[model samples]
Target: MSHHDEEIDAAGRADEFLQVFKKGAEFTQDLLKENERLRFRVVQLEETLKEKGHDTVDESPDAIELKKKIEVLEQEKEEILGQIKVVEEENQNFANRYIEIEEENNMLANLYIASYQLHSTLDFKEVLQIILEIVINLIGAEEFGVLLLDEKTNRLEPVASEGLVTSELPSVAVGEGIIGEAVHSGENYFIDSMEGYERDFEKPIVCIPLKIKEHVIGVIAIYKLFTQKDEFTNVDYELFTLLAGHAATAVFSSRMYSDSERKLSTIQGFIDLLTK
Candidate 1:
C-alpha cells in the first residue's frame, strides 16, 4: 500500500528467490556426481565388452544422438536461474523421492523382521503364513503363493498361498508353466501379460524362485490385476530378490534342523535299548 511496504515485500520475494536457487544448486551438484559415476561404469562396461570380443555401439549414429541429448540436458541445467522459489520446489521434489524410498525401506525392514522370526520354527507353518501375509501387504498383489518342489518327482507344490483357491495349483512339473520355469531354471520370471498361460490368470505377474545351493526349492509368485512391462521398477526387483534369498536360506535351514533332530532321536532309542 505504501512505499515502505512495497520495499519490504520486494525484499521478502528476493529472499525466497535466493533460497530456491540454493536448493537448485544442491540438486545440480548431486546430479553431476551421479552422472560421473554412471560414466565411469559405462567405461568399465565398454572395456569388459571389448575384452569379451563384443562389438560396441558407442560410435554408432544412435549413440551420437544420445550424446547430443545429454549435452542439451547439461546446457539446460547450467542455464537455470538463481530463483529461490524454483530451487525450493526442486528440493521439494527431491525430498518427496527420499520420503517415498524411506517408506519402502521401512516396509522391507518390517518384512525382514517378520521373516527372521520364522527362524525359530516352533510353528513353521504359522511363520510361513505370516510371511505370506506380509508379502501381500508390501506388494499389493491380488494373489500369491510359495511353491516348493517335490525333490523325487520335481513337482511344484504350493507350500503356502494367499488369495487363491486351494485346489487351483499343485503338482506342476518343472518348466511347465511360468512359475515352473522360474523354479526349474533358478531365475526370476515376469509375464507382462498372462494371455498365453490361459488356464486362469490374465494379469501382469512376477515369479521369483527360491533356490538354495543352486537348487530351486520353491517359488514366490506375485499376481496383479493389470499387466504392464514397466509396472515394477528396478528397486522392486532388488528388494524382492533379497527377500527371495532369505526365504531360500530359511527353508533350507529349517529342513536341515528337522531332519537332524529326527535322526538324533532315532539313535537315542537304539542307545536306550542297548543300555537296558
Candidate 2:
C-alpha cells in the first residue's frame, strides 16, 4: 500500500485503540470506587456489632459475605490493571510507528516541492542557485560545487560552488579522480563512513553525476557536510537521484537558452549597424 494509505490506516487503528483504553480506564476507576465503598460498609458493620456486645464480629454472616465480595472485586481490579498495562505498551508502539510514517511523508513532500522549484526558472544562474539550496538545506552539504563538462577541453569546470573558493576550484579531467570517475561511469560515489572526514579539494566525500539519458553532462562534488549531519539518510539518496536527471535537464536547457539570447542580441546589433 502507499505510505499515505498506510498512515490513514494506522491513524484509524490508533483511534480505536484509544477508545478501548479510555473505556478500560473508566471501568477500572469504577471498580476502585466500589471496592472502597464496600470496605467502608464492612468497617461500619464491625463497629455496630461491637457496640451490641458481639465479641466475634468476623463470624457474623453479613460480615463474611461482604469480605468475600471485596476479595473478588480486588482480584478483578488487579486483572484489569494488568490488561491495561499490556494495552498501554501496544498503544506506545503504535504511536512510534505513526511518527515514523509521518516523517517519511514530510520528506516526500519536501522532495516534490524542491523538484517543482528546480523547473520553475529558465535562468541559468537561478537553476544553479536552486540546486545549491537543495544540497545545502536538504542534503546538509556544507562545501560543494556544481561542475559542468567543458566539451572543448574535455574537463569538468566549476559553474557554481558553496562554502569554498570558486575561482580556486581546479578543473578536473573525466576519469581522473573520484568526481571524474562518477562522471565517466555515470554512477554515484560516496564514502561509507563520514566519521572524522576531512576536506580534500581533489577528492570530494561524495560525487553525484548529472546525466541526461546515457550521457553524463556534469557532476556535483560534495567535499564536506554540516557538523550536525553525522550521516546520510534514505531521502538524501533519493534527492541525489532526482538531481541526477532533473538538475541536468534544467542546467542544459537554461545554458542553451542563455546562448541563444546572446546570439540573437549579436545578430540584432549587426543588423542595426548595417542600417545606420
Best by lDDT: 2
**Given candidate 2, what's the lDDT at residue 29?**
100
Residue range with the least summed lDDT across 10 consecutive positions in model 1: 195-204
- Give the per-residue lDDT digits (tens) of candidate 2, residues 1-276: 999999999999999999999999999999999999999999999898787756455778888889899999999999999999999999999999999999899988998888898899999999999999999999999999999999898899998999998877889999988888888999999887877777887888889999999799999999998989988889899999999989999999999999999999999999999999
- Residue runs of model 2 more than 4 Å from their true location after superposition: 1-79, 266-276
Kindly provide the TM-score of model 2 when superposed on the true structure, using C-alpha atoms.
0.67
lDDT of each: 0.72, 0.92
Top-scoring candidate (TM-score): 2
TM-score to true structure, per model: 0.56, 0.67
Clash number by candidate, in order: 5, 0
RMSD of every candidate to native, in Å, equals: 34.0, 33.1
